[model samples]
Target: MKRRKYPKANKMMLVSLGIMTALSLPIQAEEEIFQLDETVVTATRTEQKVKETPASVEVITRKDIETMGAERVVTALKLALNLNLSEASMVGNQVSLRGMNTNQTLILIDGRRMAGEDAGSTANVYELDRVNINNVERIEIVRGPVSSLYGSEALGGVINIIMRKPEKPQSTIGLSTGSKQQNASYHLDLGKQGKWAWTFDTLFTDIQKQRRSETTNMYGPRQFYNISGTYDLAEGKNIDVFYERMSEHLKTTDYTDDGGREYFTNTRNSYGLTYRGRTTRGNYELRTYYNELEKNTDQLEGPGSYSDFDRANYKTWAIDGKNTMRLQDDHVLTFGGEYRTSEYRGTRLEDNGDAVSTVTEHGISKSISEKSVDYQAVYVQDEWKLSDKLLLIPSLRYDDSNRFEDSLSPKLGMTYHFADNFRLKTNFGKGFKAPSISELYMKMTRRPIPTRTVIVIGNPDLKPEKSTSYDISLEGEKGAAFGKLTYFDNDVTDLIGTETTRAGSVSTSKYVNIDKARIKGVELEAGRHLSNNFTVKTAYTFLDAKNAKTGEFLQDRAKNRYSVQLHYDDAQRTGISSILWYEWVRDYRYKDDEDKDTDYNYGTLNFTINKKWNERYSTYFGVDNILDKKIDELVLEGRLWRVGMNYTF
Candidate 1:
């Protein structure tokens, strides 16, 4: 691995920080100040003001999304401080928060979980990308351990996407075209004040293939579709249903005349139903969901000779229920339970000189080509307002799985309002992730040639990975200026890895739990509204992540990262608004499969302008990665421009 210097970029970042800090100071002492009253529901399963929540949380409102001109959920997520996005050759993009692996973070839509792992124990972060940004009301991010409430995969934190509900009868249509993609969307609402209120939304997108160097499409063509509807049964009661589908086609070819070619196709379908209600004494919700994913690949040698065919299928079903009650004036109790099941099936066939034969099958046995697992969990939490200036929240959860040992997770948090506009908070939580079905039952063998054989086997005796996290923070707001500083540390044990063994000409690989890790970091966030038309926001993060046993730096974890944005609006007085954003990520170290290390850095600038024609129409234009910064290994395309219009009636 090699390291490069970027002194010019570093200087610019420092100057920008100084200017923002200076501008925020003058607005703090103004007599009339704007206060933020944003509310969020992911932190506690109940709605509460952002400032009153006991945990560290960040929110991206609907207005913010529109102002930023983000076309995908991943684009919006990257704006958050301390979060890292990586592009994988097969998985599209993977997201990591606070130096944790992608699998350690949990993703949710309307508080419902989605599938994370495949039959090969590989995490697919791109699953969240299927969501339509037009249907989103807002995004809430909680930046600490939440395993006590959500069960597994919460060691890093949680990202919850909330959908919009209509309050009046209206319809909206949107269309956009870009240098690399095209998009269209439609939404409608009817009978908002009646007992039979309903809302509908849909989106379609098409992305063209991107080339690398002179040839080879790094990213293939992709198409997506999503539909959702909600019906109101009565006051404080409703039922909602949603369905989404996507198809992708990819092709890659070698430059040589006798080179091989590969074609891949992927299709996914997901749907869910939710019922929720509220009463004088309590509130409750019930939800159920089903998801299916299929992948197919074909390989061809020179000209049109068949080489191989591979296919895989994954299915999941889940049901969950939750209830909240006000037991006393100072105590609010919440209870939840969930059941989930998943299955995986896969097969591979290779071509011989005379015929094609089955080469690999993934499952427990030949008779049972599909491997399945079931999981159950129950959790309870209490939010106690001990005093006017003090608050405490305690939570506990127990989980049972058919293939792993039973486990328990607990968390405790406290907040003290020491001053009129200031608060101190601290939290401690235990987190764990059970072994996936692929890590416990998958079996496969491959024979590339006549004398070489490769075998891969799962380890049913592997232990679950566990972590203990601690965080403390100081938050305050004075007039139009607000800021927060936080420090966090996490200790993990029994981390999973692969071990390889070789005997003569045969090679074998197996999964093992034999690693430990420790990660610590500091985060600082500050923002201010200078006036009715001008605003500034900034965030910075410093992380120290390493292997606990070997004392080596962790791979793919950046040491420094920051983001800054400047926004101006005329309050619709002038019918024009604009925003400028910049992000910097310091060089990070990563180890390749061949035992080589590399360091990389990226800096990008984005700007958007909006023009309002009237109350019923608006147009927007934006440029992404204006500086054209490139990372060859990440397959990032540079300098994209887009324009779009929205209509409402």
Candidate 2:
């Protein structure tokens, strides 16, 4: 084994932190309250312990995110039960869950959908640089069908990003430097007793230049800010407002076969505003968002000039209102309604000349845009206590959209407690998804003008896709030991995507209400405290995806994934704490027409050490990719290694 030395770049982080400390004078001090055992509000829409949630849910605490050396949102999710990550483009990253498409999984920021991206793909949790991690309280992940609670995109599940609110007056500053790039961040929290509370966080990072396939110097810079606050009006009544702005400069280099190289650059800006109010009668929320994605390409060394440039923009506004009432000793009822309007615009212009000498401008010949969706949905759910140890939950929802016909979904679930420390829950549900504008109506050109064909055609009569899902879970806890096991299966129909055509090149295959697809999987999680000084946590997942009609396995589904973590903390040793983690994942083989079986297995090990000098100050060091293993998370793409540190005050 080799003892890896700290890179000189690490000193840059220390120097930056020293300057931040010297600039701020020691002012007022506040009590630092440590919150372990987080209470989740997303799994059931009510406060419950992670161990008590009947569904398969993973709750990542802010402490866990910080200690794991994870800066982005999706990095924390990598070790989750069954999630797959892929890069769609410079600005687009896709995440699929339980062998479902990316669009089937819903992403929620404080219980609201992020401004929707172009239909087929979306930025996952990590791509949302808008929300600062310093402003996050905790993340709640509900795995399996949640369309009963959240409409539409929740067919796979829901990931809710809960932002941090000021519990007390506090402020913290942090700086970190890592391979290829580095970032600096700050957070300010203010709380006034019985009146108001708010938080503000900002971050800036410079990305390092890297050569992908091509030998071009390219890197992406990210900057973002978050502002959120709450106002108390009366008992059980409050108002919450949140806003976020994110900007990033993304660059990608591609090697060409004709002794030339190509470089792509994209500028993305996203902004969102949401307001919510709750009263004794009910709750209401209103949100509006705008996202602009523009791209500019420059070939550093090529015969052709900067050509085939484009931009895509999405704008959305939505309103959601709900009410909950306790009708009887055994019955609780909830009802909600939501409306959303979204618009997508695509524009492009091509250059036909040299670098300095501008010759032909193709004008904006490819300005095809559509404002196709204004969706509405109404939902209701009821929880009935059949007995002291038995409960039943039933829900129904209806969605109406202009491009697609109406849909009705129903869900039934039950949770039974046979013992004080053990419980069993089973849920059966139906879900649906409407075609995106891109899928229904888009014209793209690939070859040189005059001869390119419209590869994709819209079917004005496209129908909404649907799925039926079932999940069974068991949870138990005794003293310091906790464990959970879940099994899930989903059958999908009328999934829309492109398939190989007779022409050899891919063409848009019309939506076919065809064969049934099935995804069956199991998840196990366990955690225990070995002693007062040591704790261990681990999880494993096994998945099988197949076509119910053909009896053949689905493509690109990982067979096995597992993770283990150990933590040790000692107050006697200068308040020192340490954590060691290892993760393993089996590669997913594509089941193409040839029936090939190619596989790859990879693992990662990481460690972190932290010391609290006193109550008000703390510093931490972390090393990731401990083995320096060059594992390609996405084969054909470059490998990744991340490490950093932080000091909080």
- The positional error of residue 71 in candidate 2, measured at the CA in angstroms, is 1.2
TM-score of every candidate relative to the true structure: 0.90, 0.82
Per-residue lDDT of candidate 2, residues 165-203 (tens digit): 777777777776665457788888886756778878888
How many backbone clashes does every candidate have? 1, 0
Clashing pairs in 1: 1-597
lDDT of 1 by residue, 1-649 (tens): 4667777767866875675476457543575565568888888887778887888888998777776666777766657767777665445566677888777877887777655355333564665666778888899999888989998878888889887776578998989878656778887866455455566777777665555543355246556555566677788998877776777777666554366667778787889998999998789999999888787767665577655566667788999999999999889999999999976666521120112234442222212255667989999999899998998999999998987888899999898999998999999999987777667665656654448787667778888889999899998877778788899999999887778899988998887897899999999888887788887888888899989999988887778778788888877833878888887777576666587767667877989887878888888888888998877665557887788888999
User: What is the Cα-based TM-score of model 1?
Assistant: 0.90
The 10-residue segment with the lowest total lDDT in model 1: 348-357
User: What do the candidate models score in CA lDDT, each in turn?
Assistant: 0.76, 0.64
Off by over 4 Å in 2: 1-37, 86-93, 121-130, 193-196, 210-218, 256-304, 348-364, 447-454, 500-515, 570-577, 590-597, 631-649
The local distance difference test score of model 2 is: 0.64
